[model samples]
Target chain A: MKAPVAVNGYGTIGKRVAEAIRQMPDLELKGIVKYTPDYSVLVAYRQGIPIYVPKGKEGVFEEVGVKPSGTVDELFGSVSLVVDASPGGKGAQNKRVYVERGLSALFEGGESPDVAEVSFSTLCNYRQALGKKYIRVVSCNTTALLRLICLLDRHIGVRKARAVIVRRASDPKEDKGIVNTVKLDPPSIPSHHAIDVKTVLPDLDIETVALIVPTTLMHVHVVHIQTKRSTSIDEVVETLSSTPRIVVLEGAKIGIDSTSKIVEFARDLGRKRYDIYENVVWRDMIKVNGDELTIVQAVHQEAIVIPENIDAIRAALRLAESAEETMRVTDKVLNVGLQR
Target chain B: MKAPVAVNGYGTIGKRVAEAIRQMPDLELKGIVKYTPDYSVLVAYRQGIPIYVPKGKEGVFEEVGVKPSGTVDELFGSVSLVVDASPGGKGAQNKRVYVERGLSALFEGGESPDVAEVSFSTLCNYRQALGKKYIRVVSCNTTALLRLICLLDRHIGVRKARAVIVRRASDPKEDKGIVNTVKLDPPSIPSHHAIDVKTVLPDLDIETVALIVPTTLMHVHVVHIQTKRSTSIDEVVETLSSTPRIVVLEGAKIGIDSTSKIVEFARDLGRKRYDIYENVVWRDMIKVNGDELTIVQAVHQEAIVIPENIDAIRAALRLAESAEETMRVTDKVLNVGLQR
Candidate 1:
């Protein structure tokens, strides 16, 4: 029998995670919790997915002309795990209810490290989340960083890494952000994203600084890593190209020069929702000088972490004995790295 | 007697270098070469500075109502050394004339490293240029990176250094640049900057990437350096604060945040031409975690290297026996670090 999973929130990540769960053969989408009876809740209801509401909000759903499937408690009691994809800082408050009912839960990056048993990035620490009661999949930026850093560590051995994160001001659907200025995200050095990466890869020495630009499509990381031993550029290129969820685009050959062009490339690829689930690395930006490597890659902020959220559920439930097994199953279902 | 010096191009860097030479007690500005009979030629001519023209372009000077002081060959014969501030790539072609006349020349960062005997950064290797026939001062961005890296290396002993150069799309007076895009300057990795830094400091390991934002004021560098041993934040801050041609500004206390604000601060200080000759470092961006030091500094593209050009002349002429003496003399005459 497939293990039933309930997504506690049907917002940005929760909706994507629910759709991913329904496609997996080993998992089934039990229900989704919605606090507001807005257009999104109506859309999910019209799609034939079960919608659970709070105990006192049944009248609100009825007023929207959509009958609720059940209460949030009923959804929690029926599923094997709950993926809490609520807004940042809200998951920490909702954790008390999940623990009171003896339920295993996975939180998003917004929660503190204390709220979960393990801070999870599938490529970096998948086994650590196996059988854990609470696991937190890191933020979108951290997931993008780990996928490259961990892959390099496994092949060429990374001794030190530094990143300059050129961040997108906001998601595509958001209306608020800087209009014409390049603002420092925190107005400080070594922003919080660096520390979050260390929560999973404790032995890695890395430092990062972030700047929020006016663009909203994706975030670009200018990364420099020192290898443990001397490695050639061809070796690094081969390893990343042969990997599962990375798409290498040669700027000189294909004319993919900017982050905006990468988004248009995704749209041309006919991806569902124009979403790119892979890290888009420019082949022209990869340089290997002796033991040091420098490269530039762009991460689709809205969709890069969706696949990791799926793998987190399998790792937390012990559905697969190893990380590679879970990744193979998840990558195949998501059609990750196949469109390229 | 003041040593005679001639400026080989009266453009952006040449005019500033000529003015700096005029203010020096031990150096005299003999004349400046003007290729175009533009409005700037009239300004320099009215200032009582001699204007020299190429062999055949004497008519161009006559068309602009400015009488030629002499020919380019005459300027080369009169000066003890010629500061070759010609346009980039033009300096390489003009080097043969200086070599033929047996005149020592100082080239700007635009020329190749082979164009000079040493790639120069005043703070890193002032002595390396002493008594040299040809010296090339590194580019503006490379000069900015060398200042902080060499400073930190002195007090904390830097083991590895990495930089992300956020470049201005163009100088303030130029009309050619990106309109509303953040472009990778070369659309490649490890931009020529890292190798340029190594040309001055041969033993230091460093990597750099550059991005061109749609701003014309100044270029900012996000730098990370790993010290040879563990150090505290106080030591790194104190080291940078006590150095010449470097300014430390607090973001919270003074509300000095972005690079644009730094220019405003310099304007408010009533600086001539609103030029900030020092590297404006944000205090809030200085962080030391264990052995790593991270900093964000803004280098005014037009003015930061003017002070270096003065020190380069002193070093190349053997006017000062040590780097510290040259810096002290140059910094005092330019009122560097005085506004703060």
Candidate 2:
């Protein structure tokens, strides 16, 4: 019998998580939680995925011409695991509900590391989250960094890393206007990313600064790493190419000159919502000067975390014995790194 | 008195060089040389610039319903200097003609450093090319690399450098099809660019690999440098911000997210041919780790060489007393770094 999973919150991350969970072979998606009646709720309904709302807000969906199946609190009794994809602080609040009902839960990146027993990156810390009551899949930016840094650290031993994240100001559905000026997050020397990555790699000497660009497509990261020993550019490229779910792009051969082109390529490939779950690393831009390595890559903010959440679910349920097994299953089912 | 300057081979670099020379206060635009009467030749004719052809090809222009002013050989006598913006290997062949006519010439980067007395980059080797009979302005990629390397070497003392040149397949007017696969130039360990930079900074140790992507807009460069001393990212950004022809783009502000947007921004700002002559450095993408610094910047393939040609013209004519004076005049007339 498949384990039942419920997605709480139907925002950017939640919608994707719900869809992914619905497709997984080992898990059955019970329903997705909605706070209000939005276009996404209709989307969930049209897809035949049940929708659950908060007790009082259930009628709001009816007023908007959509009928939610039941209340969000009722979902806990039927589901064995809850994936909390709510807003930042709300995930911590929902943890109380999950704990009371004796349910395992996975939290999205927006929640603090304190909300979970372990911060999980499938490639970095998949085994550690096994059987944990709560696991936090990292943010898109941190995931992009970890995907590359973990590979480097495993192969050549990364001593220190510094990165600048050129992030998209808002997702397509969000009404927030694109920033007109580059603003550094306060106490700007090192942004929240520095603190967040440490949750996965406790001893990583890393620092990050972020700028929100007006793009709704993806986030571009300029990463510089210092390895414990010298490595060549070819070695780095070879390692990255071998990694799962990391798409090393030859922009010239594939006609992907920019992030927009990459998005168009993804859409042309029939990706749902034009999502690229893999980190798009410019194959040509990877270079090593002595012991220092530099790479330029892009991360699809809405899609990258989806796979990690799936892997986290497997680990939390003790379904996969090892990280490789979990990653292989996730990649095979989701077509994670298959680029035409 | 204005120096008579003739531009040979009106292709991507040639046409821009001709127009830039036409607008300069110190130079007079003589007829431009044409091998065949193409659309560009018609463009020159419509702009009222004289068109000269090779001795045998003069009739070809007449056959195309375009009148040629004279033969290319005649241009040597009418003009004191020739900027040979012809195709690669053509510049070396034209050197014999310039030498035969006792006319000084500046060759484009396509030619070997041996083809000229000194390879010139206005920012790096302006003084070296003064009163030289033959000077070669390095290629667009070299010019872009030199611009930043020279700045870093001057401000913080660069020890060594490595770069990957993500090049465009062809200019917008060329018929070369975009590559369907990313291709590395043969013997990709160190491309010609590795040796090209040495033309300006003979003592600097640098290596580069190049990949041709399918795009006509611009070339993106990923650079990593090891400085002689440890320098903070803030200091590096400050030094670059103060540089004349390097435009530090706030990737967050003004919504310049990708190269296409930067091109669009240039068009909106009413840039001629949507050309961005300066290096578009992402302000937030610059970072420092230990003694190493990394930068991701885009170089406009056509326009970057234009300003350097203007500065080279002044140096060839013994017009500017210093690199500063020449750069100031070129920036003032061309509006080098101004972006909307």
Q: Which pairs of residues collide in model 2? A: A252-B213, A253-B180, A253-B181, A253-B182
For candidate 2, lDDT tens digit of each residue in A1-340?
A: 8889999988889999888888888989999888878888888899999988888887789988778889887877899899999999899998888999999999988998999999989888888899998999999999888988998888889998877666666787777844322233421336688788999998998877665444577877767788999999788878887766788888666666567778889899899999889999877667687797777787889999999999999999998978898888788778899823
What fraction of native interface contacts does model 1 preserve?
0.37
Please compute DockQ, using alpha carbons, for every candidate against the native two-chain complex: 0.32, 0.06
Q: Which candidate number would show the highest lDDT if scored against the true structure?
A: 1
Q: Which residue pairs clash in candidate 1?
A: none
The CAPRI-style docking tier of model 2 reads incorrect
The Cα local distance difference test for each model comes to 0.85, 0.82
What are the TM-scores, per candidate, against the unseen true structure? 0.82, 0.74
Q: Residues A62-140, candidate 1, lDDT per residue (tens digit)? A: 9988899999888999998999999988889999988888788899998888899999988889888999989999988
lDDT of 2 by residue, B1-340 (tens): 8899999888889998999888889899988988877888888898989998888887779887789888877877899999999899999997888898899899999998899999988778789889988999999999999999998888999998877666676777777744333334432246788799987898998977665555677777768788999999788888887766898888766666556677888899898899889998877667687787878787888889888888888888899978889888788888887622
DockQ of model 1 vs. true complex: 0.32
